[model samples]
Target: MTNSRPVVNKPEIDFSDPDWKRHFQEDFDKQFSLPHLRDILAIKPRPTTFSLKSRIPLDDGDGAATGSWNGYVNDDDRALLKVIKFASPTSAGAECIDPDCSWVEQWVHRAGPRKQIYFEPREVKAGIVTCGGLCPGLNDVIRQIVLTLEKYGVKNIVGIPYGYRGFSDEGLSEVPLSRKVVQNINLAGGSFLGVSRGGPSTSDIVDNIQAKRIDMLFVLGGDGTHAGALAIHNECRTRKLKVSVVCVPKTIDNDILLMDKTFGFDTAVEEAQRVINSAYVEARSAYHGIGLVKLMGRSSGFIAMHASLSSGQIDICLIPEVPFNLEGPNGVLQHLEHLIKTKGNAVVCVAEGAGQDYLHKSNTTDASGNVVLSDIGVHIQQQVHVH
Candidate 1:
């Protein structure tokens, strides 16, 4: 008599507990073993002895050297272009036989073509050094550049240890890179080479670039970093060095006008939107509420406005460029009440530097002593008594 029910092995498994060691091992294995199609096509053999010179031997009518050698065997330089082949030394003569000669024509034809392609594989070494503040896609860009340059027959590209600071402090070292040097770095956050917070001036950066023989320099940072890059470009021009300089915009502020979007802005906006949505949900649950989400935007309304618009939970958005008045008939309090009386829940996004107080009291100041404004989200929320 057997029971038809299947027996289960109930082993005690604590899935709730964080197994960091297992997680790390799994991630490490996945990262190292990952396959890429680009790596296969990039593997090309480097030349061994590329400096061998192929000189053409000439035949004189009376065994006298003519042409550019001009009756001199040691002149060895050829002005007239001719192709010749080496023949086995005869006991009677010490001369290289010309291929046109029939006696050794068979041997010359077997020696292959006279035009030789010299494969002088000079190992190209490059490095990426970043300075001042962290940008979102610096590491990703570094990875792409290294991979792309390798495909361009560059064998030795390195990471400048630290930023410009390391060149002065720890000195410089050639960072050996393979596919392994920048593996899984595209998904990485922050600079993998690590950046310096110190903004090196023009002269110091140029000196470092020249001292290191840096062929190309990629500078990733905000306005100050961009200014530093510009200074470096100017200095390089003044010195007549062929240092190719480029700048990658890496600010979360989204204030750089030349670039459509900086790397960190998307991340910043995403985080702000998430927080605003969460706050809206919490405020909605309270049922008698209005929420004021103060977001970071010192000079631009991009972050505050984008977050508010994306969430669709915020009814009002106040930016730095647009002035907000909390005392008027269509004031901050009036907006909050309007949303609440109609929708029962109100969310407002306010830029941290949104111009004056909502009640129009004090004034804000930027680094350049320009008048900025206080965030109006909190002021409106306070007036509405949002719990």
Candidate 2:
């Protein structure tokens, strides 16, 4: 008897084989032929082209399109989706004016050549610290600067604690930054670094920056902070330390010069309006005649003036820049009387900076360690009620 052994021949398997294309094509066709995918692929691409006039057409009785349609034909059907897709990262899919919604066309007409970035990305080595009072968009400006710098392989960032106090002749209290640390910080209120009334006028601050060897310093604060950075810059330039100082203006007082619209001013205005509006309502109800509301501002009348303008109910506004004098017949007293007699009701907006020219000053200090503003509103209110 002869023992029979089964013959086994290995089936050839070659990933790089020429016939692999056919096999892969067959598998792809079969896998992608699922009912759901078939339905999606079956949809005829939507039309995106539209025509519009250079100007809006005048409305005649009949609603027929009639005008020099300005030859404004959108030839690029893919432009809208491309723009929308580009903006989606920042806008998060909010409605935008993109002409093309087709992903295929967008891919074809993309702005730049597609390539993978392979260089080991480096950090920004930049740091921002807040000082004094907190402000709005402090986090936003910090985040934007970080993000922009990050794209250029500079991502190393730190937040100096408690403003410049965090950085002193001793050293910088550093918080290492990464994509994870500052993510989604834009449009946030207050400062991520947290602010304090520390390091107002300290030479040790500049010494701290030098000791830490901070590549770039972004100071998120007000005039004092700006002055601190400026002083440091001057010293650095004088001694050649190569430290770069940039300032992001922020304050509730809005007194800082050069920059327009600091962070907290918007919030301050909204808050002041609420207070003024409520006071006006109460004045009307109590028949207290009028409420002379005092809003915050040391050197700037921005807050008080804005409150009156925004609160339409407030009949008159008084700012520090425009002094209130009662010695003459054409004084503020006469002005309020005129408004009361004509408007039936009056809500006056007065800046805290507007001192009492006729009355005595008070001995008080606010939370910021500044002298408290005298309440001219009370003096005016008293005199008006007496008369």
Candidate 3:
């Protein structure tokens, strides 16, 4: 009767038990309310309409209704038209009409017909110059330009060698193009027309154009090349000469302002994905190892983003748009260490321009006025080694 204390029983705990771990995870999930794959994949449907008046009128032999524009829309072109029609409109009072706007929805031939060349087909001397860096599908553009001009009945087409300099360089050569010369050129990569850096004065370029009697000039390059083309066009206009200037933007960087997607971008991303896969394999093969991959993206991180998303093998991705740290509790190095300690391996995909702020800057510029970037990949590798 004096010892009336209540008897108590203690609960036993086992850390190594699989059922204990599973129960712990279940409790954690219940407390945190983690998201499910089904929730992420569940996207709501939005209303869309594809109905539109046919842009291309029935082709009449005379072709008077269409003016200089050829009215032909393929299935792909029709699909693009629907996308343009459904896309968000530009802000009010915008100066330039959006390329995707309904007003510019008509699918016309890339080569011109709203404007006519001042010369006849045989007398029309056309010059094609490829400036800037290499890009995929350039040969295709060249071949198409040649064939289209041929369709327009132009026989004198010349390839300006080594970019805009071909216009003024005395020793630089020019290649005469024919249907046979460019027949199978598109089978290869790089520009068959060749490319170079820098250009001559605008007046000198205009003089060369006049000397060659080139009625049409097609400039294939990035913004820099387009600037040169604009200068040449202005000079020709000042001299009261009628020369049609066409620009086909080319850049593997894919940083153009208004363009949706540039040529060579898909190929670049595909190649990058292969590298990411290789990194993943290497990381998985080593114990507590980390594999890092660097991709091409000087000003924009499109390549890195696309590669990481496509491969689905990357543990972490760093881009220029998002700033990251190398030290501190929430830094990349800490995160990598945590990942390796927990999962035994980690993979990182970084863009070339991801960590510019962490490095010393250099006052270097390329021929196209692009600033030379520091090697972010090497810096990251060194930092990883130190940590």
Which should have the higher lDDT, number 1 or number 2? 2
Clashes of 2: 11
Ranking by TM-score: 3, 2, 1
TM-score of every candidate: 0.58, 0.61, 0.71
Write down the lDDT that model 2 would get.
0.60
Residue pairs clashing, model 1: 355-373, 356-373
Per-residue lDDT over 131-198 for candidate 3, one digit per residue giving the tens place of the 0 to 100 score: 98888889998998897777656779999999988887888878999789999999998889998878
Per-residue alpha-carbon lDDT of model 2 for 222-283, expressed as tens digits?
A: 76666667787666666655456767777787776433467778878999999999888876
In Å, residue 160's CA in model 1 sits off its true spot by 3.5
TM-score of 1: 0.58
By lDDT, is 1 or 3 better?
A: 3
* Poorest lDDT segment (10 consecutive residues) of candidate 2: 1-10
Error of 2 at 159 (Å): 0.3
lDDT of each: 0.59, 0.60, 0.72
How many steric clashes between backbone atoms does each model show?
A: 2, 11, 1
Q: What CA RMSD would candidate 2 show?
A: 26.9
